[model samples]
Target chain A: MVLLLVAPAVAAGIVLLLPSARAIMRFCAMGTITTATVAACCAWRTFAGGSLQAGEWFRMDMLSAWHLVLMAGVFSAVSLYAVGYFSKELESGAFSRGKAARYAALWFGAMDAMTVVLLTDNLGVMWVGIEATTLLTAFMILTHSSPASLEAMWKYLLMCSVGVALAFIGVILAAASAESAGLTGAQVLSWTHLLDAAGSLSSAHVKMAFIFAVVGYGTKAGLAPMHSWLPDAHSQAPAPVSAMFSAFMLNAALYCVLRSLALVEAVTGSDGWGREVLLVLGLVSVLLAAVFIVGQRDIKRLLAYSSVEHIGLIAVGIGLGGAGAAAALLHAMNHSVAKTLSFMSAGRIGQAYGTNDMRRISGALHAEPLWGTGLLLGIMMLAGMAPFGIFLSEFLILKSALEGGRYLLAGALLAGLVAVFVGVMRHAIGVSWGAHEGIVRNVGAGWLDRFLVAGAILVSLVLGIWPCSRLWHVLEMASALTGGMP
Target chain B: MMPLVDSVHVLILVTCLLLLGSSRLGACIRTVAIQGIVAGGVLPWVSSLHISMQLLFTGVFVMALKGIVFPVLLSRAMREASASREMSPFVGYGTSLMAGVLFFLASLWLGAKLPTPDGVSGLAVPTACMMVSTGLFLIIARRLAVTQVIGYIVVENGIYALGLAVAHDIPVLVELGAMLDAFVAVFVMGIAIFHINREFDHMDSGRLNVLKG
Candidate 1:
């Protein structure tokens, strides 16, 4: 867990010492892989029911353990993909080595900051971590000096900064609410203590606090109304960075929301108002994403909207409560893996075609088989096709909704999912099949690319077919920690 | 001292209104600076210690950074950009001023409704909330990037004011960290504005609409 928090800092230090961009890329790749290994081991230990608490500042419980594993795994793949991507850019002289080195350093820094957000139990410190990630990644999004990139970066910064400020207000209010309950000192803001003293905390204050936090973090999670900046940022950013943003950063923000949800649920009992809010936001996000994806010209922007859709689905799952929360948690993991694969494949395809515009690119299968295959399979999985983990989790979500007698909601969700499937499949088929018209240049594929594509596909497939006892145990423990049914 | 702190709140409220009412970027920057000074002035008054070496030094830093350093940085950037006036905003200045008034009143109402945390001054919470929201409103309403940055600084000042209100046993280092982070955020914003001006040939964020979906 400590390694997860500090790996990026260590990588940054080493990268700073490296003389060349190639060396920096190699170091980052190695460092992130090591971090991923450590995180996996930590997750295993935590899954075996081992717990570690670093004072009151940080804790690795079952919930955080799952997030840690996902974050490390996704970031590791992104780092390796970045190495290949940046090296190509460097060799082609697209950017200076110095800029590439700086990007690598900040990339690891962002990973480290996000790791802290996952591991830390303190709400204030978690805000700090999230804020730090924002600062770090905002620059990464603007690696290029285009006007569009700058605008996207600024929009990202301003909107997220405002959103985070509101979140801080929520934190202050939560602390204030706890103080109103006669709790004093550090106990007033501690998550554990707040849960213990939930009955004493004012429900009205808690409700207000949750509203602000959900809006604030929900902005980061790419929920609608506040999701205006996401498409621009994700599409404008480099591909590997885009992968990281979709695959894990959104999940990190969702984790913060879930944490607050736990507190809010404890205080308000099963009032379901919070769940209703989540459901509303979720459905809106899906419907909006489906509409936008249909007209999306840029492949990256299409993927970005897909992220909004997936996040919406996860939110809806969480809102359904009971078994839905478990399904959502599982969906979160599956989506991260599948989305990373999708973005990485998209990045490679975008590079090969020399454009991200779907209109300009065609016959990706004939052009680059591995990338084309990856994009096809990944999108199919994201669209919730059978035999993928997303399919299973999404099915479970529908089952839970029906079981809960939310048939109308289940119907709407199914409609949205189907709309998304049609939209994405249309684009994917258009991009992946047919005659190759564009000049296809062979950009030599790397081992890392194969590893990511194969590994993600294998994981999704295995999770779809069989549920490992270890994963089940971890999910059970996580559900308990979240105060939801497993 | 208490009266001065209360009056500072009123001054901040007025400055926030003036900011929304102003069309000129220079005037907006000036209004924000004055708001910052009022915010800095209230900090020492809210603290328990009347006089101390550390407190005195912090006040000096606040005055220098928030009052002098930030405004100057913003002014220089505006001068370099050579865009003095904000022609039109998403919302007109008069409407924004009205919105600012509503925000202040709403904040006051919110403060009155909530139970105060221990050691928090009666005046500070509402004042801080008002200042924060006003700052947010300015950022949203203002067209020019530089003015929006000034608005961000004003919001940070309000957050600092909240920190002062609830200081109690809050460590000086944490306060310093927050201050330093705010300073850096504005500093980075200044650099970003410069880059924006150079790239886009205008600091008006209204013109930055190339990446729409």
Candidate 2:
């Protein structure tokens, strides 16, 4: 776990000193893979019941363990893809070596910051981590020297910063509520201690705190009404960075929501309030994605909406609680893997075609077979097609929703998923096989690209067909950590 | 004997209303600055421990940075951008002013409903809550980025007001860190607005909708 946190920070330092763009890319890739290995180890040990901590400041439990693994895995793949992706740009001299090196450093820095967010138990420190990620990745979003990219970066920074400020209000309120309960000093805000004393916390204040936290973190999670910045940020950012944003960063935000939900549930003794809020927000997000995905011209933006849809699903799962919480955890893992693959494939496709417009991109299978196949397969999985883990998880969410006597919510969720499926399929088919006009070969697939796509696909399929007992155990443990029935 | 804290509470409430009702961005910034200075003035009265010279210096620094320096920087940015008036907001200024009044009333209701923690006076907590919510409203209602930044400062000021009410032993380091983060965040936003203007050819976010879905 410590290695996972420190590796990127170390790599960021090394990346700054590297002489050439090639060296920088190699350093980052090596660091990412190393971090991923450490994360996998953390996940394994956490499942095996081995604990690690940095005094009281940081600790690894089943929850953080799962997130650490996912963050590192997705980052590793994206970092590898970035190497090939950025090298092509450098070779074409579209970007100077200096700019590429900066991108590498910032990418690692963002990864390091995200790891800190997942690992830290301190609420204030976690805010700092989230803010650090925003600062580091905002530059990455504007890597392209276009007005659109610059505009997107500004909107992302401004809106998210404001949202984060609101979240701080929520944190302060929670602390105040704790103080009212006689839990003074650091204990008032500590997650572990707060959870233990949650039942004693003021219900009204905690409820208000939860509302603020949800909206604040929901913005980062790309939940609708607060998700205006997402499409711009995702579409305008470099492809690998977009992949990381959709796959891992969104999950990181959801992690915060889940943490807060746990406290809210404990204090309230009923998930009804949290569930109602999440259901409304989640359904709106799905419907919004459905509306926007149909009209989306940029393929990356289309995928960004798709992210909104998947996050909505996870939110709904969490709101249901019980088995739904477990399912949500599983779905989080599956979605991160599948969505990262989808974005990476889209990035490569966009690079090859020189445009993200579906109208201009066609016959991808004929033009670039490996990337084309990756994009098609990734899209199929993302659309919740059979034989993918996403389909299984969505089914579980529906089942859980129905079992909880939320028949109306279950029906709405099903309807929304179907709408999203149709909307995404329409765009995916249009880009994959619609027409064969004006396809350019600016970049082609390499072994690393093939490896990432194949790895993501293999994991998703394997989990769908045969859930690993170990992974299930981890999910169960994570559920228990949230004070839910495992 | 009238409670001294009640006077502080009234002062903060008036300042919050001035912030909400003020049209000029310069005046709004000055109001926030005054609120910060007043907050510093109340710090010694509220604290259980004797104020050390270092703590006094820290309070002065907070007043200088948050109260004075930040607003001046925002005022300079506003002047440079040539945006003097708070443009027509999403919510009308009249509606917002009414909403601010309602928020003050709601905070009073909330404080009355809940049991106040021992040693914590009831008056300031409710007022602080109202101020915080109004500051959030200002951020959401206003259009210009600079105005929104000032709104954020007001929200933090409200939180600081609450901090004074409880008088908990938060580490000076943490307080300094929070202030530093806010300073840097505003600085970055200022730089970003300059870029937004250069790139989009306007600083008004109303026109900055190129990447929306």
Candidate 3:
């Protein structure tokens, strides 16, 4: 567990201090990410044995273990894709060697910070981890800082920082609830202590705390109404960062919400209020994403909206509980796999055409066939096409909703998803099939790039059709971490 | 006779009122500085939950960071951005002042209704609430990016005040960590503001209307 956190931070420091040799830096980054990934996977496999409790500062329970596995999964893929990404950027002279080295370092910093969030037993440190990612990724968002990227970074930093500050209020209130439970000093802010005393914590404070938590962290999670920053930041961020943001960053934010929700429900005795609120917000996010996807010109923005929709679906599933909770975990895993593929493919397609505008850059398959096909396939799965995990996951959520007697919510979710499916397919198909009028600059996707994308899609498919037995047990454990579970 | 802490709380509220109606960026910065210094006064009760030594260190440290350090960063950002004075207020002075009063009234009403835990200082909740309302209003009601950053600082102060009411004896390590993160957040934003100045001759976020949906 310690190694999983330290490897990335150490990599970041070494990457920063190295002479500006891109290959050396890339090699270092890959080595550290591989170490972290293997360690995390080991933890995940053995999680049912018991949690790895490291003092009071960090722990890896079944919940953290699974999230750690998923976070590392995305990191591994993004790290591989980044090699191809930076190679293209270097060839284009967009990243001088120094700039590339700095990029490598910041990438690791973000990875380290998020790893901390997943593993921390101290909510205060978790808040710091989340805030640090905002800062680290602010730099990453504009590796080759342009005016637009700067604007995006500015909005992201300010909005997320403010949102996170509100989350601090939630943290304080949670700790205060501990005060009522007769805990004090450091134990007040410690997750283990709070969880142990959760049943006796003040209900009013917990309820008040969660409202700010939902709004504050919800902004970070890109739940609609508070999601104004999502499209701009996601669209303008460099492609790999977009992949990280969608695949794991929002999940990190949502992870905090889950931690808070579990406590709230524990204190309030599972009265169902928390789940209902999540249901409303989740459906609203889907509806908003469906509306946004229809008119998006930027392909990255289009994928960004799809992420919002997918996250909404996951939220709804979590909201439904019982089977819904398991389904939500499965859905998050599925979405991360597919969304990473979609973003990376869009990156390549954008590179090939030198613009993200879908209308302007047509005939992607004609030029960069590998990525174009990947993009089309990614969209096919994202639109919840048959045999895809996302489809299965969404179907399970609807099934859970019906089983829970939430037919109206199930109907609304179905409608919103179908609307997005049609609109995204139309846009994706148009971009993939046509001949782009503009000059194509990027060399076609390399073997490694194609393998990563295909592997991601393959993982999603396997999870859909025949999820391994171990994975089902892991899902059960993950679902049990939340209050939504029966 | 009112306790010294009560007077300090009043000053914090007054600073918010003064900031809400004031258009001069420099004055707003100074007012925040004074508020920062005054907020140090909140820490001095002799019974002392934790070690008095640690409390003294925290008070002086917060006073220095909020009073002196942040103001320097902001003023530097203000100068580089080269727009001294707000020039335009999204919510004008007269209306903003009205909102400030309303913010106070609302905080009072809400504070009255909030469930306070046993033995908490009564003024903490209402003071924190007013600070939050004024800060959010400051963020929305301003056009310049720099002022918005200041609004964020104001919001942090409010959160800090709320932290005091609940969670007494917050771990010194976590408290310092939070403060350090706030400093870094401000520093990062300050650098970005400098770039915003370089990219466009002015830091008017209104000009940032280009990337709209």
Q: Report, to 2 decimal places, the DockQ of model 3.
A: 0.76
TM-score winner between candidates 1 and 3: 3
Per-residue alpha-carbon lDDT of candidate 1 for residues A386-473, written as tens digits (9 for 90 to 100): 8999999999989989998999999999998999999999999999998878587666677777887899899999988896867766
Candidate 1 residue spans exceeding 4 A from truth: A483-486, B1-4, B40-44, B47-62, B117-124, B163-177
lDDT of prediction 1 = 0.82
Candidate 3's C-alpha runs over 4 A off are B40-51
TM-score each candidate. 0.95, 0.94, 0.97
Off by over 4 Å in 2: A270-273, B1-3, B40-58, B87-95, B110-114, B166-173
The clash number for model 1 is: 0
Candidate 2 residue-wise lDDT, A83-109, digit = tens: 888888887787666887789889988
RMSD of each: 2.3, 2.5, 1.7
Give one digit per residue, the lDDT tens place, for model 1 in B9-111: 6777788778878888888887887777767754565544556677777777888887799889999999989989888888898798789878877988987
- Classified by CAPRI criteria, candidate 3 counts as medium
The 10-residue segment of model 1 chain A with minimum total lDDT is: A477-486
What is every candidate's C-alpha DockQ against the true complex, given to 2 decimals?
Answer: 0.42, 0.45, 0.76
Identify the leading candidate in terms of DockQ: 3
